[model samples]
Target: MSSSTSSSEPTAAWARFLRLLLLFAAVPAAIAYAFIALVDPWGMLPLSLPLRRETVTTNQRFSYPMIAQDPRFDSVVVGTSTSRLLRPAQLDELFGARFANLSMNSGTAWEQAQLLALFTRRHPAPRVVMVGLDKEWCESGPLRRLTPRPFPEWMYGGNPWRGYGEILNPFAAEEAGKQALAMLRLARPRYGRDGYADFLPNDARYDAARAAQSLVPPPAAPAAADPAFEFPQHALLAERLAALPAVTRAVLFFVPYHVSLQPRPGTLDEQRMEACRAAITRIAKARPGTALADFMIPSPITREDTHYWDPQHYRIGIAERLARGLAAAAEGHPSAEGDYVLLVPPVGH
Candidate 1:
């Protein structure tokens, strides 16, 4: 009876061990199937479907095409959407230099520096890199952290998977398979263009004209003026400017803002603006080949409600005038002075 009992105990132990093995094996297989079914073929699973407003378009259908197609650009524009008004074609015509606009919406100084590094790696360091300075870019935060995924360097350069493992986890063999699938076009490229260009009045006016509607609206009320805003991010801006290769000529321009929408008196906004201007002034004085151009003057054209897409983006005519002003400021630099004047608009329009 004792022998029979011992034999039964051994059989029971074997059964339990087999059950545990099957459980472990089955769990992974189930997860794998689910991942295969739900994850996009690119090894990227949408954090949220129906892409949000902030998603950086990763596919080559839009701005990637612009970068890939233009390999000979001798100049590049780096800024947020505020600088997007300055078109590459316009700058190329004015400066006689091949150019590309590397501007993105809400792009932080860190991202801009990274892009500059990327550009220097591939192309000849641009002869002139016009950086647009706006008040909001000084705000603290990783500008793209709230989006579905961190901004991928692949959006600007090739190698989508370059820094993937560092930014994401759950690195698995299945993910490798998925990436292979994406390469073969079996999976959709996991990004779409948010209408960054849509904010420009040029496209708005075109759409309005096509729809047989007038684009102009009535004049807007005067914007409250804030004279006290202090900008702390200018230090970061200075660091970035200093790090640029000696071959690159950098120009920082404070883009115009509609006076009608200016901040109120004694507000933090005014203080911040003052700090930024002061910081930029100091930077220009210290840097050998750097210059500043301030174009934030209120004019009849700029004060009109229709002149801007919102409070910051200007119409095509205004953008053209500003670009020409920038060209003039850049050209006016003397060969020996190592200093350039900041050009402000003439009084009263």
Candidate 2:
């Protein structure tokens, strides 16, 4: 009896210790899970507790779907970081429609397609769908669907159940805490609700020396390309634009890159670029309520070093000018300021 008692006591003690260990582990895990579910850091959970949400993270691939699917916004601006500065409020006024800027930093063409898919899925007849074409659209190879930054494919638009597992992570828990702080007014929003953010490092002034440092000299002449060279990404773009309703005004503009980045005249680079532009122009012409603008040339905006924050990004004044140009381009009117040229004028022009 004594031997049995000793053995059984240890066994019971071991079981109790294991139970305590599990209890400690599960308690915190449960709390964290509840916190994430309630706060909905990504602002996607259907059961998310009532809270005023703002974009609290710079991971735009994850943060932008909120802007894409926002009910208040009936239109979306989809592109890479170059398009982020196109303020939604200005576009709203210019286009006479509610707008959301869903541009992502370093967003690949495929990623932009996914964003467009999400917006269109929610809004079948958006007033406008502005695609600020980037290099990815003209890139030669198969379109790279994503950038180096992590993109949550599940969060974009998919079976809702797929994301719960993905979002239940330590990173999401941390975001939840930050989101809670934002709700409490202790933290500030990183990007605006409509996904506008002046991400450039504010300068006291645009120093010519500083601008020159960021600008690279034009590239040396490149070897001739094979005649069969093609732009396959344009097809992807065509597919997306074709999905839009006829009533939806689709404005496709080559994002105005700095002159230094533009290809030299009549080189293989220009050959491929002009071909891509021609392809996009054809797609615009074939579709109603669609227009195309070419802003990739050596315009006053593109040639001025002071106008660009970098070869890929422009300052606020330039962004405004581009926005105005887009408004006119949508109506088949060429840029009055000569910042862009209309390739496919609007319908009825």
On lDDT, the candidate that comes out on top is: 2
lDDT of each residue in 249-295, candidate 1, tens digit only: 66777777666545444555555555666667777666666667765
How good is model 1 by TM-score?
Answer: 0.59
Each prediction's TM-score versus the true structure: 0.59, 0.94
Residue 204 displacement in candidate 2 (angstroms): 3.4
All candidates' lDDT scores? 0.56, 0.85
Each candidate's number of clashing pairs is 11, 0
Candidate 1: where are CA atoms >4 Å away? 1-70, 138-149, 153-232, 264-266, 333-349
The sequence of per-residue lDDT tens digits that candidate 2 reaches over residues 1-349 is 9999988999999999999999999999988898888898887777888868878877998788777778998989998888988998999999899988888887888888888988898899998999999788888766677778988888776675676787778889888888999999999988998888888877557676777688895665564756546776777788888898888999999999998898877677787787788888899998888889999988999998988777888888888889999999999887877899899987843
The most accurate candidate by TM-score is 2
Error of 2 at 95 (Å): 1.2
Residue 7 lDDT, candidate 1, scale 0-100: 91
